[model samples]
Target: MLETLELLKISTREQDRVEREFNMGGAQSADKGHGYHVLRVQENSPAHLAGIEPFFDYIVGINGIPLDTPESRVLQDQLLANMDKEVVLAIYSTKEQELREVPMIPNRSWTSNPGDGLIGLSIRFCTYEATNEHVWHILNVAPESPAELAGLIPYTDYIIGTPHVTLHSENDFYEFIEAYTGHPLRLYVYNSDFDACREVVITPNHAWGGEGALGCGVGYGYLHRIPKTNKYHNSQLTYQGDLKQQPQQFNDQSLPVEKSHPSMTNTDVVTVIPTTITTAPLIIETPAEPPETNRPQQSQQYPNYHQTIHFNNDKVPLDP
Candidate 1:
């Protein structure tokens, strides 16, 4: 999880700035006893600009109306009620480990229908459980593209949001681009290699002479999926494609040329097909000894002329 803390301020002086398609300073709440805990903060939204982070901040008060009632839905109700007015929030941050006041104003120009909250925040009926429901994996980024200019790394970064829009799949990202064409897209992404999340802004435009609006290819993946460390092996291992992890030593004879790349992505790496492998064993041998030969010779005589004979070999006779 990201451990950074920031305080953001957004201006709603003009009514036009207050309204957009996905216009609620991108903040939602979950039940928190008398108060409500922040669950999601849209990227570049008013909530995000005000430094409101989901799961790490709790909303204890709103517009000076202390959300201390037993009714858990009170805060969401009150915020939705004052959709077009200045709303101040009392927030507690786990990163800062303190309480602070944040100001947010709803700028929606369109009147919300009955039971409709258009401030970009989705109210959660249950406890907020962190999961990888939204993914923004950049499969390929074109040169001189907005994504490239924004420093979006391909195959390593996960896109989480576009200002107030939370992207979970490629279709969501596509729809958001089509709906908000030519809008300055502020993106919040989880970098797998860094194990950290970061924010980047890319203005979607077709004048860049690219195929797509952003000139980038993206796919869906789990947010929690991180790249594994590298390992090196002596004699048995060889350098292949990009090496993102550390190196280790091993005795394996060969690695699959296609499947043994260094980087481990969330998509295809998991479904890699195994390749054939072979092993080599060690062996030893010894030369056989020549056939034994014997030569007899008399050495000395004792008591009645005795003769001594010996065999010429490394081994001695049992009798000797």
Candidate 2:
């Protein structure tokens, strides 16, 4: 039997002005590993009320915003200009292969913080070119950690630098935090969602009822590790051979204390994909650092590094 289906025609008109908060639903860039789809949706949001499913809906246009054109950034800027107002969204569903119009108002009345207004949503420029290197992906932020206090967004922000040191690896960041514990340190961060970079100041401490000095989890791996640095800015996008090599040497003229890096113990390594997040880290037995000998040996991977965490069934803070 042949099934006949008729397309339902519906008005794109948005009803009454609810004066609701401004938001077009939260979204994450498809260029940054996440496919071009809605990533999140706020409760009772306009996008929610309209039944826009996250992780599935792909936005092709909003009102008059052009998504796939070269002037896409310009269109995004215009969309921002209409904040706290009603707008029409053209969304496509890859699963259903159907196009529909979603009418919604963008507002920021949900979030209590006024400075964080405009929209309770996150968005990023659609770019797949890896131009971000020497960056740290935040795995977890403790309940009341200094990182959480500083408004550092997990899974969205990438930690780049600390005051005078260029962090090359996870060890570098861990070592830097230990040296600056209990002291205010300026950190450089990149917000992948906003396609912007900013500086945030945080004081690392152990009194926050957390495990490590910073009370946050960070790691380097295939999915969540540092990315390549972009070197293109001119018209003719010439191909650069490679990004500058990351600094491997650590020099701390400011901090007088010195510590040596510890070696991992002999334990069967187990790799598991954590259920909370998709970061699959290898669990290796970390033994306590051997007592510092008066007779100095070869230079440690990171001088003056301390182990404040271990691999357990609980959240494993990757510092090795």
- Could you give candidate 1's per-residue lDDT for residues 1-104 as a string of tens digits? 11111112223321122123112222331212223444343333445555555433455555544444323343555555666676666554322233345666
Off by over 4 Å in 1: 1-130, 166-170, 222-320
lDDT of 1 at 170: 31
Clashes of each: 18, 11
Which candidate number has the best TM-score? 1
Error of 2 at 3 (Å): 70
Off by over 4 Å in 2: 1-133, 168-170, 225-320
Residue 274 CA displacement from its true place in model 2, Å: 44
